[model samples]
Target: MIPVAEALERILSALIPAPAETVSLPEGWGRVLARPVLARVTQPPADVSAMDGYALRAADAAAGARLRVIGSAPAGHPFAGAVGLGEAVRIFTGGAVPPGADSILLQEDATAGDGLVTPTEAAQKGRHIRRAGLDFAAGDAVLEAGRRLSARDIGLAAAANHPWLHVHRRPRIGVLATGDEIALPGDPIPPGGIVSSNAHALAALVRASGGEPVVLPIATDDRDAIAAAAEAAARCDLLLTTGGASVGEHDLVQSALAPQGFSLDFWKIAMRPGKPLIWGDLRGTPMLGLPGNPVSALVCAVIFLIPALRRLSGLPAGPVETRTALLGRDMPANDRRQDYVRAELARAADGTLTATPLAVQDSSMLAALARAGALVVRPPHAPAAPAGCSIEIVDLSSLGV
Candidate 1:
């Protein structure tokens, strides 16, 4: 048996990022940046007004003094005339601040008349004027390579004059569930039969990890049938299979993979609910074989499969978002394996996050998984944690749940 970390490293190294693709800004969210995006044009290309106010010379403005108004300016329109000493121009939000004007007196503080204005207070320098290149300068590296596009990122790119974006191509992942006793939903359950749910669960996992999942049909526990499915899955950039990985006599996933030029990277690990894990490569496509237990498969997918997908897409997965939370009840540590305890996060009156583990923790309870906000990460060496004890919480919802 190999250690989990070593197997993870091997699987990650075997996968590489796909080629870059040009996509529209609307469709680029969560996609990694393929090129260093520079500011093609400076935001607020010139000095502009941030609010509706009077643009005037800051040094000359005095409280309660009425001054002549030069012209009017609104958003997307610039004043044709400049402001002279003791003169102010009527300006609205997003309008260009006229040349030689250093500050603006908010409309509430000033009174307006025909070509005349009055200030309620002395206008201060650098007030309400957004200076040219304040947000970004021309040629400035506004976004670095590998930055994942978000909604705000799209806005920034637009501000920087990017009409389109170049982002890393999403890796195509194949999801398969193997076993003879498994049946799809809506199918009549035979004696000792269970539903084949691993594929759908894995598809959601693939989406959460920023990859596209191509779900394959259930591959029954037969050497030839499993081999044919494995060969087809190898066409994608990565393959993920659940079940048929243990030492059981009928487990044929290992044997089927051997004929397809795939080598075993690992077999078992010191882990609870997931001792039959397998890792390898198939025809240049990396594959991760997870236990059929619902919770175990999901946890392994997040821990191992997700990071592998990140590497395959050239994304920096080291910065996964995690927060602190207090345990709602006492918990025990594992004997020799790590454990991920799913829990719902509730904010306390004092602004603390509390992780309350659900009572129904059976791996088959999908509803409980859906209600969880995050997983409380505990290593094998963790001591018993009492109620209100703080622990590291991995944000599952942030992972695109």
Candidate 2:
């Protein structure tokens, strides 16, 4: 068995970032930038008006000052002539600030009629003027490589004159479920049969982690069936097989993968409810064998698989986000295995975060997991903790619901 951190290090060290592809800015959000995006043109391009007002020399824009309206400058139509003394240009919002105009008199403070305008309020130099390249300059590094593009980032990139961006390709993850007793959702169940939900859950997880999920057909426990499914999954960049990872008599995933020259990196983790986790390289693709229990499979995916997907998408391998919370009840000493206890979260009147571990932590209980908002992390062999003890927790909100 290996520690969770060690396992993560091993997995990350063996993988490489995915290849790059050019995608339209609309489709670039949530994808990692493979190269820095430089500004192709300056924002605002030239000095412009920030509001609909009269652009004139600041000295002539005093209260009760009168000036002749030489021309109008609405957005996209620049006044060919400059503003001279005692002259003003009617500039609308986003309109270019005509030459010789150093300030603006807002329309609310200025009355205009008969090809002339009068200032009812004082104006100062540079007011209401958007200087050229105020937001960004040409050739500026608008965004750096390894950034996960957000909606705001996309907007900024578009403002930087980028119609498209070079970003990492979303990895293709293949998910396989192996168990004869498991049936697809809505399928008629035989005695003792259960719905095959791991694949679906894993597919959603993959998509949430910025990867495309291809759910393979469920494979029975038979060696041939599992082997055929394994081959198909191996064609993807990453393969995730749920069930048949343990050493049980019926656990045949490892055995089936052996004939395909799968190079096992590690097969167990020093973590409760997920000790049977498996990691290895199958053909040229990375593979992970998750335990059969639903909660265990999903938890391991959150801990390990998501980060792998993030790295493959050219994103920084950031640590799992954790926050400190006070324990709402007593917790017993843990054994050799590190524990991730699902817990409900609440905030106290004093803004203190409190986490209460669910009474039952059975790996198959998806209901309890659903109700949980955080995972209370307990290291292996941790001492018993009384109520009010501070504990580290991973907020599930960060991990897509």
Candidate 3:
């Protein structure tokens, strides 16, 4: 069996990023940029007022000084006349500062009368004025390639005059769940069969990773059935299969697809609850085979599939992030395989996180996995750790798992 990190490295190296496509600004949110977005126009195209006040020559506006009132300029309207000596123009916020106006006398600090205004407080030159290109200049790269656009990024792109953006197409993933003992929810079940949950759960994980999921029908534990179902998903960017990946008599994913052009890269990673993982290619499509158990399937997906999706979607690809936390309880020494212990996380009064392993970590118990907040990572052959010992953890809540 290969180590988990080596398996992941092999999978990512075999894939490529999705192609680029054009999308409107409204649809660009949450999409990764394929190219940089340059500013089409300068922000604050010209010098403008940052506050509602009077625009005038700074030297003429001393305390108690009076100046002749010129025409007013509101936002989107430029004062046609320039401010001469002892002259002021009434301006509102966002109004272009008229020529020869080097200062702004705040309205609250000035008294106005018929055709004239007096400064109660002296005006400072260049104060309350937004200079041209204050935010960004034309031709500047406002957004770089490969960045996932957020709401704030959308607004910045819009302000930079981008009506449309070039972004990488969302990766299309085909999810296939297999097993003779599993049936769809709400369908009449076969004797002793359980409802299929792996497909839907993995689909949600794909969406969360910014990929589009195409859920294929469940393939029974038959060679012809598995081969046909996999062949049907050859056009997808990636094909994810659950179940029939182990060594049992019913596990036929490797043998069944061998005759149909499936090439094996590696199998059986050194990890707990998910040792029966499979990574290979079916025809021309990349395929990942997860374990049959729901908890195991989801956990493996979080570690492997999420990073694969990121690489396909043109984002910087790497393992899911982890952080250090104090152990809330004692744990025994680990053996050969790497372990991911499901645990609950809480913040102590000192604002430090403490992770406590759940009582039951059975791979088939989806309820226990749902209640878990994190997965405390235990390396192979590591010594036992006691309460308050520092440990690395994959935060499930942060990953939205």
lDDT of 2 by residue, 32-65 (tens): 9999999999998999999999999999988998
Compared with the true structure, what per-residue lDDT tens digits does model 1 show for residues 237-341?
Answer: 888889888888878889877987888877897655577888887867778899888888887777778788788777875324578998998887656666678
**Candidate 1: where are CA atoms >4 Å away?**
64-66, 319-324, 328-333, 342-347, 356-376, 381-395
Steric clash count of candidate 2: 0
Write down the lDDT of every candidate, Cα atoms only.
0.82, 0.92, 0.94
Tell me how candidate 1 scores on lDDT. 0.82
Model 3, C-alpha of 209: deviation from truth (Å) = 0.9
Number of backbone collisions per candidate: 3, 0, 0
Q: What does candidate 3's lDDT look like per residue over 195-224, in tens digits? A: 999999999999988999999999999999
Q: Clash pairs of candidate 1?
A: 67-117, 69-115, 69-116
Kindly report which residue pairs in candidate 3 clash with one another: none
Give residue 254's error in model 1 in angstroms.
Answer: 0.6
